[model samples]
Target: MNHWLMKTEPDELGIDDFAHEPQRDFMWDGVRNYQARNFMRSMQPGDHVVLYHSSCKHIGTAGIVKVTRAAYADPEQFNPDSAYYDPKSSATEPRWDAVDLCFVDKFPRIIPLSELKTLSALADCALVRKGNRLSVMPLSANEYKAILATTNR
Candidate 1:
């Protein structure tokens, strides 16, 4: 299955929030970028995900999630009251999508971005690249393993 890294602000919805959900899952929404939306479109049920905490006190991969559902039009896009609402988007031709992610496990502790940058194996990781800020990004199996390896130690 494809591996992906999805960033979320901990104050909004962190790994713990997902775990507390009745279904232990939540719809990943509010993605406005085309590239990030496309990443969600490409996802499939059973795909693995690294839930990274971004724009927080401790930015890093905080936990794992399993894609429980594939892409569908983001409900938030149609709600005028929602911050993610898109007036240009119509139900007939929506401009955004979302996916359902189920919590897998939170890391023993955050694998800090500073630490990731120091790892040669993750040098090429988009998350580590300067000025790269796409919330959703792809990861090679080895890259996924390398990050997890840090938590094991």
Candidate 2:
């Protein structure tokens, strides 16, 4: 299975939301960026994901999640009342996709972005790369493990 990192505003669906209802499969959606949407479409069941909290006072890697279902057309994209609705999309042709992810772990404390930037193993990671802002990003095994290792420190 592949590894991925997805960023979310804490107020939206953050890691705590997963921890609160660990058994529920949350639909990860509302990704408007083409690159991020493509990455979501590439995810498969059992893939691991790093949950990053952004646009908040304590921006950092919050925890881990596992993909329980692969990509499917995002239902919000067809609902005009939904914030993620796409006027150009239709039932026959979807312009966005979403995956199902369930909680895996929530770190005792957030791994701050400052700390993540210092890890040599993540030097090539887009999450730490300067100005690289795709909400959904791929991660190498080494990179994934490196981030998880930080939880013990």
Question: What's the C-alpha lDDT at position 55 in model 1?
Answer: 90
What's the lDDT of the predicted structure labeled candidate 2?
0.94
For this target, which candidate reaches the highest TM-score against the unseen true structure? 2
Model 2 off-target regions past 4 Å? none
For residues 86-150, write the lDDT of model 1, one tens digit per residue: 99999999999999999888899999999989888888888999999899998999899998998
**Candidate 2 backbone collisions, by pair:** none
RMSD of each: 1.1, 0.8
lDDT of 2 at 10: 88
Displacement of the residue 118 alpha carbon in candidate 2, Å: 0.4
> Cα lDDT for residue 77, model 2?
97
lDDT of each: 0.91, 0.94
